[model samples]
Target: MNAPSSLALAVPALSLKDIGKHFDGLEALRGISLDVAKGEIVALLGTSGCGKSTLLNIVSGLLPADRGELRIDGQPAASFRDWRRIAYMFQEDRLLPWRSIRANVAFGLEAERSRRAERIVKAEQALRLVELDGFARAWPHQLSGGMRSRVALARSLVVEPQILLMDEPFSKLDPQTRAQMHQELLRLQRFKNITVVFVTHDVEEAVVLADRVVVLEPRPGRIRAIKPLDLPRPRIPTDLAVSEQVRQLRMAL
Candidate 1:
């Protein structure tokens, strides 16, 4: 595997070989194969209803594929396993109205009371990671859309998952906020060395953030094309090199 950095050289975190999924009579995915190295950020780019989210769900164990094999660090997907190594952030913030931001972020850590103090420290550190430190006491309803998204990100990171599955987490934000969050996510992913498999309908966003951009064909989705993006980062959206690459990718779509 050609990892961008040495930190990404661990065993494959997640792998899907000939994975297929069907919902009732509708086939959602067909024979999809991919691998996410320890710290790679892979983007699945396609139009709406392309089965990217379904594939993500299967990998996350929220859903089961009807055919083929899925594995986590070489273990078969169907085996009883520790799923704590994977974290998911959906399009919606999914914050708890009853819990404060700090409490919500710390929710996952509650089971291990033997290290409550350390968990609290980790929660605060995660909040800081998403630049939401001072808002720890804020309620979910009080935050702006972007801030709420940050809180969601903090919640995911607090668990220190080896892999993150993000499903258009910033799609609801305004354009400006989305751009800012993109840069922030790049920084966070770099610092944490977490493998990320993100589903986005935006071609430009995929071009900017992915080490490889994969497009799935419509209904009964299957991998249509896999394009490697060798661009240097931090990517500037308006920069000629980046813009041209994005245009070409969109054209291919």
Candidate 2:
């Protein structure tokens, strides 16, 4: 993949300034500030109740921060008109049982009210991107766990999002399948040059995939440390350097 252009490096794909969120009387997130560069892969690493998912929700425009500002592609998120440029994948696959794999992949386009033929074409392309074109007509229940995850990923990518937010999307997969998904995600991200900010508690996963890992502390979750991983690609967990990085991240958490 080519290096990010100077202009792309200049403007952040996602920016949060002193972001704060509250639920009832408890503060979920506080003083959270971050900038995700275009085509960069960032991981939010933390234990439960550390607001990793909460922060993702705010970035995805599903929840509003009580204080602070959010900007997408250099514009204030509240005023950002190109919301279609963002797509989110939650923890669960969340594929509708009733819909075929192709239909499920096309679900995101429903909000745009596109014609059925156009949605079908785009959905097919997305399935092909995830290497699941053959299962287009299959039901969600007919696929394996890993295949379902790819379908979920295909659903997210069908919209051609510039920024993809994931909330522990592969946490449920077995170790081997999770590793495969990690590679798949990296390949697609490189191909699409999509900026990614994903929430993950696994130190190894974060170290393996992130350009930078933002560790958060619980109880009004706040940034504890930001570690940039400058390691080489295809970072195997068994490798000395990669294992050391994972060890350090685990210590931080």
Query: Best candidate per lDDT, number?
Result: 2
Over the stretch 114-165, how does candidate 1's per-residue lDDT look in tens digits? 4867877888999999988999888999999999988888888888888899
Which segments of model 1 are wrong by more than 4 Å? 1-10, 111-115
Candidate 1 residue 28 Cα shift, in angstroms, is: 1.1
Which clashing pairs does model 2 show? none
Model 1, position 226, has a per-residue lDDT of 86
lDDT of 2 at 47: 96
TM-score of each: 0.93, 0.97
Candidate 2 CA-lDDT value:
0.94
How much does each candidate deviate from the true structure in C-alpha RMSD? 2.1, 1.5
Stretches > 4 Å off in candidate 2? 1-5
Report how far off residue 71 is in candidate 2 (Å): 0.4
Task: Give the range where candidate 2 is weakest over 10 consecutive residues by summed lDDT.
Answer: 1-10
Candidate 1's clash total is 0
